[model samples]
Target: MQDFNGQIAFITGGASGAGLGQAQVFGRAGARIVIADVRAEAIETALAALAGEGITAHGIVLDIMDREAYARAADEVEQVFGAPPTLLFNTAGVNSFGPVEKTTYADFDWIVGVNLGGVINGMVTFVPRMIAAGKPGHIVTVSSMGGLQGSAIAAPYSAAKAAVVNLMESYRAGLAQYGIGVSVVCPANIKTNIAEASRLRPAQFAGSGYVENEASIASLHSIHAHGMEPIELAEHVKAAIEQNQLYVIPYPEAKEQLRRHYDEIVDAVLPMEADPEGARKRTEALRNWAADRARVFQKSEG
Candidate 1:
């Protein structure tokens, strides 16, 4: 892990933005970069940029939500690079802004599938093989500041990213026994095209009065316009990797929010009382609601 020279890095969503920035850093550190992206043209552009910088990199068209595609990408990376990649960066994600009541099930599915499920798929498809090879490796899953603390208007995004943060934490604990390192990044806001690159709602959801129209999208763009640069966030990621840190938060403001979130949770916890079954039932009901919605979406898609 200390040495990255000649190592291989497999990065999802590496066509542009933060993912591509991370690729550039890894490439500069002498690692062979395997960049997977859903956008064909963007991947080509990224590859060209890396080549111009004298970095070793290859691009593959990938949809991280597709398990078969993920597996095939891993195989292809090994075939082209002659070894399993030592680094896996699960950085693909999308953003949607609206009240939970106005967010359609499709929106939730797409966000959760790409943001959280994608990271799970990457870990499942890559981590075991890395362990099997008995080589030093690292996995970095990109969450967000919203992952640490809920956002008022981005419920689906917050839920999905929070899942990623927890998943990476669990993976870190388990992987430590196997000599693999794991890092989770919680970026507050970065200048990324995620809002623009997001897929449009299907007609069903578009007409359901739950989709974010042009105005909302534009508002989100305005916020991103004021966010940090991808390169600066990439620097934090690289530093975390070098230091073997488990959590990487690039924004100072985000650190304060995380502290506040923890304090709020502690404050909300009340002393145990008799007949707490009602509270437990309410929690279970919420869980079941989320699960039921997820199931309905999967069934419809299937």
Candidate 2:
């Protein structure tokens, strides 16, 4: 995992922003890059930029939300590269601010579809191919600091980003047997084009509860203007991948904030001292069930 030399990296949203940063960083480190994105023009631009640096890269126009298209992209990767990518970057995402209560199904479908669903599609499509290749690999997913806590203004966005963190956590253990590493990058804010995600909303998902306008999108720039640069953030991600580290939250304030947020949940738990016997019995029952399940699985495998 420490070496990315000649490794194939398939990155979604690779046309611009964070994804493009990853492409540049990883490609520079000797990884063959595949820039997968929905925008053909942007993909061309990205490929050209990578080429100017003499980085080995290919561009694939893909809508990660489309499962069939995702599968085809997977096929295209294998056909073009002669192998599945050793590194998969599920970096595409979208966000729109709206009152939590006013959030529409379309909003969830679009926001969650890209942020969460796209990650799922990438996992489903690539994990099997990566596994079958029988090569060690790494999967890095881009979540947000908003994911660690709920947000009234961007409920669905937060929820979806949160789900990706959980998703990578689960994959970490499961994929370990296959020599695959998983890392979730929960960044606070970045100088990226994500704020303009609303403009990409499709007609099928036009029933948005949030206001989508130039002014609203423009307002986000002020907030993210002082954010970290994408290439600089990508350096942190590269180090995490090499080290097989989990939970890449680089923001200094995040530790204290997450501590306060998680502390509340921890405090809400009823202490075992309150009902020692009940807790003992519940723990025993779960252990017995798990023991039996393990035996059953072993027998089946045997």
Cα distance off (Å), candidate 1, residue 49: 0.4
Q: Which candidate number has the best TM-score?
A: 2
After best superposition, candidate 1 residue 241: deviation in angstroms?
Answer: 1.1
lDDT of 2 by residue, 1-302 (tens): 99999999999999998999999999999999999999999999999999999999999999888999999998998899899999999999888998999999999998999899999999999999999999999999999999989999999999999999899999998899999999999999998998878878888999988888889889987777878888999999999987899989889977888999999999999998999999999999999998999899899979
lDDT by residue for model 1 over 116-210, one digit each (tens)? Answer: 88888999999878998898888888998888777667787899899898988899887987778999998888888877744543344343324
- Model 2 misplaced regions, further than 4 Å: none
Give candidate 1 misplaced runs (Cα > 4 Å).
200-214, 269-302
- Per-candidate TM-score against the hidden true structure: 0.85, 0.97
**lDDT (CA) per prediction:** 0.84, 0.93
Clashes per candidate (backbone, < 3 Å): 0, 0
Candidate 1: TM-score?
Answer: 0.85
